[model samples]
Target: MATGWAGDGAVQDQIDATVKDGIQRARSRLPSGPGLSHCEECEAAIPEARRRAIPGVRVCVACQEARDRDAAFCGYNRRGSKDSQLR
Candidate 1:
């Protein structure tokens, strides 16, 4: 499908870009170090079971879910073409 001046592959390009963006976002959210038995964001004590269950966990489950929701809503902007830049 054509998109703007792009040819048949334009839609595929957009899909690829979107998938790449999602993968990047997921990778960015991954914890880098060992799990803490406390919430990194609020300092609330993380349950001992949680730490054991999810090694390398950084933030508490609640904090992590909230952050993920925020990220999901902050969708990508794909209209940064040269034409837009010139305006």
Candidate 2:
């Protein structure tokens, strides 16, 4: 049961939507096609183990770490209270 200004099931709906969006975002980050022997960005050789493990691996550990560090968190709140939205 949703509380406050949100109607019945509104909180659940938001939670479900958030989960779906998170899943889609995660899927988008997965590299498609065959694994590359070298990193696409730095051209460093991707380890044999990484290629075998990930299947579609493209970047080396160093480059992947860098990319991860630079990546923005996609978990931004989808629903804000009316008061918050007004500001």
**Who wins the TM-score comparison?**
2
Question: What TM-score quantifies how close candidate 2 is to the native fold?
Answer: 0.64
Across residues 29-59, which tens digit of lDDT does each residue of candidate 1 receive?
6676688878879898888887777778877
Which ranges of candidate 1 are over 4 A from the true structure?
3-5, 41-55, 66-87
- lDDT tens digits, residue span 1-87, model 2: 555687787767777887898899888878878999999998989989999888899899998888899988756675776466334
| TM-score against truth, every candidate | 0.52, 0.64
Name the top lDDT candidate. 2
The true-versus-predicted C-alpha distance at residue 28 of model 1, in Å, is 1.5
Candidate 2 root-mean-square deviation in Å: 3.7
The superposed Cα distance between candidate 2 and the true structure at residue 45, in angstroms, equals 2.6
